[model samples]
Target: MKRLYHWPLDPAGRLVRLALGERGEAFETLESPPWSPHPDISRLAHGAVAPAIVDLKTEPRMFACGTRAICEHLAETGDGTALLPESAADRAEARRLWAWVEAACEEVTDTLLTERVMQWVRRDRQPDSARLRRGAHALRGRLTFMNGMVEINGYLAGRQVSLADLAAAAHLSAYDYFGDVEWDAVPDLKEWYARLKSRPSFRPLLADRLKAVRPVAHYADLDF
Candidate 1:
């Protein structure tokens, strides 16, 4: 059995989940929020966090930490939908864009998503206006870039869905969960997201709900 430890809204974890879904792999999950690290995660590896996985059926109990390690491991081993493209050039492009998505959204996650969790889930204090503004500005730039990519390639990396599309979708889904995305501003990207959102792989993410905060009204609406 494969056991995945992950936080629901973490883009890395979401990406891994989407990959697993696309590959038709079944695995149980344990929620491991980064803010308050789960004790069991430390047993896997020092400083291990969500998005980690352990293959309980393996001889030595194989384990992988982080998205790059886990997702790539799945890509290499799985028999279902190919996350990486077939051709070498397309594979390289997929990987490049996959890495790019994580990098590009780092600032937005660190600022906007973090603030949302703090303000809503934790309810510790008021959110910082400066951080929210900074993240919003960064998100807008990313949306523009992604919009252009889809406009040119039909998908993030190419004609078919790849890890790049999954990666981009994961991050954007998190932002949309908190009602941060300006979908109307990016028409092409909005259409692309709608298609991805309609997929079975995306259903688990759309169903995610926090006890403290509800997702935006249109979050689970396929046609929206």
Candidate 2:
């Protein structure tokens, strides 16, 4: 059995989970909160981080740390649906957009999600209003850009589902868990998200919940 270490709300971790689910790979999951990661993670070849995977089926035990490495590894090894496109050009486009989604959402995660995690999960500090405001501003900009892309191309890269869609959806779903997304402001993106949410691969994420923190009412509602 394969073992995966991840944080429930981490976009990178969520992306890896979605990729694994999409590929129909079964694996055991161990939660490794960002504030207090699993000790084994620090002993890995790569620096400590959630979303790391250890393929126990391999001869010497293959290990992959971080989203890019893990996701690409799964794409190469798994035999279900292809996450990356077939054509070189399309693959390049998907990769470019996938990278863009992570880079673009960095601010939102660093600010808003960080504040929430600190305040609620860790109970370490008070919520920072400035960070929350900044994150909200950045999220709106990203939502508008994504909405435009979906409105024109139906998907982030093209018609076919790709890594870009999964990456974007993973990030958006994290924010949506906290009801941070204003779906009314982006109808096209909202519709797109609803479709993604209805997929079988998304069920696990929809069921994820922190100890004392509850998700939005519509977080698990596919129709919403």
Q: Tell me the tens digit of each residue's lDDT in model 2 across 73-172.
A: 9888868889998999999999999999999999999999888888888888899999999999999999999999999888899998888999999999
TM-score of each model, paired residue for residue: 0.98, 0.98
Provide the overall lDDT of each model, using Cα atoms, as 2-decimal numbers: 0.93, 0.91
Per-residue lDDT of model 1, residues 1-224, tens digit only? 68999999899999999998998888999998888777888988877777888998988999999989998998999688999999999999999999999999999999998998899998998999999999999999999999999999889999999999999999999999989999999999999999999889999999999899999999989998
| Number of clashing pairs per prediction, in order | 0, 0
What value does the lDDT take at residue 35 in candidate 2?
Answer: 76
lDDT of 2 at 191: 90
> Which candidate's lDDT is highest?
1
Ten consecutive residues with minimal summed lDDT in candidate 1? 43-52
Task: Give the Cα-based TM-score of candidate 2 against the true structure.
Answer: 0.98
Alpha-carbon RMSD, each predicted model: 0.9, 0.9
